[model samples]
Target: MRKNERLKGKTVVITGASGGLGEQTAYRCAASGANLVLLSRNVKKLEEMAESIREKYGVSSLALKLDISRHEDIPAVFRAIFEKAGHIDVLVNNAGYGIFAEAKDVTPADVEGMFAVNVVGLIVCTKEVIPSMRKRKSGHIINISSQAGKLATPKSSVYSATKHAVLGYTNSLRMELAGDGVFVTAVNPGPMATNFFDLADPSGNYVKNLGRHILSTEKVAEKVVDAMLTNRREINLPGWMNAGSILYAIFPRLVERLGKKAFFKK
Candidate 1:
């Protein structure tokens, strides 16, 4: 496949697509000739992006207002998308957020909110598409997990837990669907240069401390767009960070002892 041409003529559904990596990936996919269904709570912004891509890339797109936490509303939103796109070829579960705070300060509400969007919402969307994809024997499900899922950090307890759940879910889902020709992937990236920290680290301390190490949303989105329609298993950004995660997975105690200062950056 040529650069930026892998997803040509495919129908892609992206959640939280009004901003962050999700939005960037949508634009890149459109540039590659894919029709799009962009879902997010920010309907105004989503509509603007869809119209802009239609003009610039000449690709058809739809902006659907949705909050996946409202599980009851998910089925209907997807039904409307299928009505227009016929059938989805790719589903990117890229909608999630985090709050950075010490565990003792974390509230029940925070835990509930994060899990609702990060874990349950992703599973619900995946469930909605699996049946049709299985019937057709072809599809791609990309879950936007995080480095926190692999290596738990000081202030990322709840967020990391949710991502861990995503990893487990994606791994098992991949095994079950491999015979059906559905490719499942998990994207684990470290901090990013995005407004994600606007809410995640409202104090701005985390971003300030982790400057330069933060990954670029556009670059990461390009990687994601490039991996579409392929048998890729995982897209872990910034080789160095993923290396640390691999070490942590193998030598938990030793890495934890040696990385205490770094882990407390937040």
Candidate 2:
């Protein structure tokens, strides 16, 4: 089938679709003729976004108020989606948050909150979708990780740990689902021009320092949608940032020595 034809009439469920990367990905998928199941904690915003997408792209969309961090809430939300949309051809685990603080400074709540949304939440969502995908023998699971997952920085230790867990899980899931015809992809993007940094780095230093190197949300979203349609296993944006991952893997100590100053600098 043709690339554009691949997503036409397909059902795509995206968590965190109220704004940022999730919102952008929803637009991209809608343009490709995919029916969108948009999930977010903010019901009003999600409904507004869904209406806009439906109007602009002429694709059907459903907005569900969801808190992915609340594992107990996922099953019912997904059940409603399945009842409304029938089946999901693509699942984007895009709802996650970060708390950037020194490992010692991060509170217990901080650790729990981050893991709840980033690691455990993603796993639960994946589990919810896997059985149906397995029975059908075709599906795509796109996980939005981060460059931090590949290379742990100073203040982003906990956030990086969560993403690393996501990367590890995605890799293992990919192999397990390979024979079952389910494609799993991990997207490791560098910083993007999004509000994520407002929460991740409230002091604004990280964004101020890295603003010039950041990718736009639209650019990253396009790449993500392309990966979905083309079945790419992994996507690392702004090649240079991805290079850092490679360097870290091959020369951890050397890379750390060179990066420590900048990574920890205020």
Candidate 3:
């Protein structure tokens, strides 16, 4: 099947569709002819985004305000979505946040909040979609994890833990759903030029230090959309970064010693 025609008339639900990777992916999916169901905490922004996507791609779209971390709100919100869209063909768990700090510097609330959005919220969203997808025996769940998941750094301990949890969940879910025709993929990209940095690093040191290595949202979005349509197992951007993950798994001590400066920069 042609890539563009693959998602024709399919319903794709994306969390955190208000901005950054989610927003870019939404556009890519719409261009490929998917009916978009966007969720975020910002209803007005989502509504506006949905309208823009509809206008640009001529695809049907629905935007709803949802805070996945809330947990209690998920069922009702998804219920409304199902009532409106009938069935979901793809689910993009793109809503997540990070807080960069040393382990000791991270407050209890910081840890809880990060886990709430990055791990628990993702699980809940996945739980909500599984029944429907399993019944149909077909669906795609794409998680926006990070390279940090594979290799932990000093200042990003808490955030790395969350991504690590995401990757673990994605791997396990992939196997469990193998016979069910439900695809689960985790995307582990290196830093991207997004508003994420503003939240993750207010001091601006991280982005500045990363310099020219940061990936672009458009590039990452294209790869991610392709993965969703093609049922790829995982997509890791900037092959070298992923290679580091492999090396770390094999020679943790050596990699840590050699890459400590880059990985644990202040």
Candidate 4:
């Protein structure tokens, strides 16, 4: 590590650390010299990544089996984390997924499943770290929201709802912790080149239509790691898309009327 000082000695806990943005963000944190608590259901892969990080970056890491959707498991998992790490410096609630389907086609199971991991589970994880962070009056909670949160489109109603909830929660949490030094941030990224589309757009039509608009997980992860420990409010990816979101916010009906075709790409 050669004492990178950036996040050296900082304990960063990242959920969904087995792959996708979670995995990429972990590497960025390691490269920045942060000790890691990598949580995901894939213990084997997590351990392999931990070993790789230790060997490559000379930073210690703990790969824990955590299925964030299983809310009951979170408390015990976080207990083990605090016991081992003594205290957490940052918490990244990145364990989430989505499926693209029209509102009429979406099932109750789909809604329940996505909310379990994307919204409820994130809240549980954030809650687990609050007392510790508040007690120390120092920490950061970064919620991995999505650009879909800002602009709802066709065939993604449920997914957008979840991300919207994340943004709402993140905003309220940041305000609530104002007296405390703990900071909260929301990362709103557009679609990315990851297995997320494997499920979100199983038919592949959406990703095909998205084309170059799809972001690289590495790019999004770098932006996220760069904002670590800072009181950054939001990290929205792909300036153009975020700009569209801004436009959508003010003239929702106009954007919807004009973007009907683009919104139906799903």
Per-candidate local distance difference test: 0.93, 0.90, 0.91, 0.93
lDDT of 3 by residue, 1-266 (tens): 12456888999999999999999888888988999999999999999989998998898999999998899999999999899999999999999999898888999999999999999999999998999999999999999999999989888999999999999999999999988989999999999999998888999999998888889989898888877756698899889999999999999999999998888664
Off by over 4 Å in 4: 1-4
Better of 2 and 4 by lDDT: 4
Q: Which ten residues in a row have the lowest lDDT in candidate 4?
A: 1-10
User: In candidate 3, where is summed lDDT lowest over 10 consecutive residues?
Assistant: 1-10
> What lDDT, from 0 to 1, does candidate 4 have?
0.93
Q: List runs of model 2 lying over 4 Å from the truth.
A: 1-3
State the displacement of the C-alpha of residue 171, model 1, in Å, after optimal TM-score superposition: 0.0
Q: What does the lDDT read for residue 211 in candidate 3?
A: 89
Tens-digit per-residue lDDT, 42-120, candidate 2: 9899899889988888999999999988999999999998888888899999999887888889999999999999999
- List TM-scores for all candidates, in order: 0.98, 0.97, 0.97, 0.97
TM-score, cand. 3 vs. native: 0.97
Candidate 1 residues 137-216, lDDT tens each? 99999999998898898988999999999999999999999999999999998899988899998889888988888898
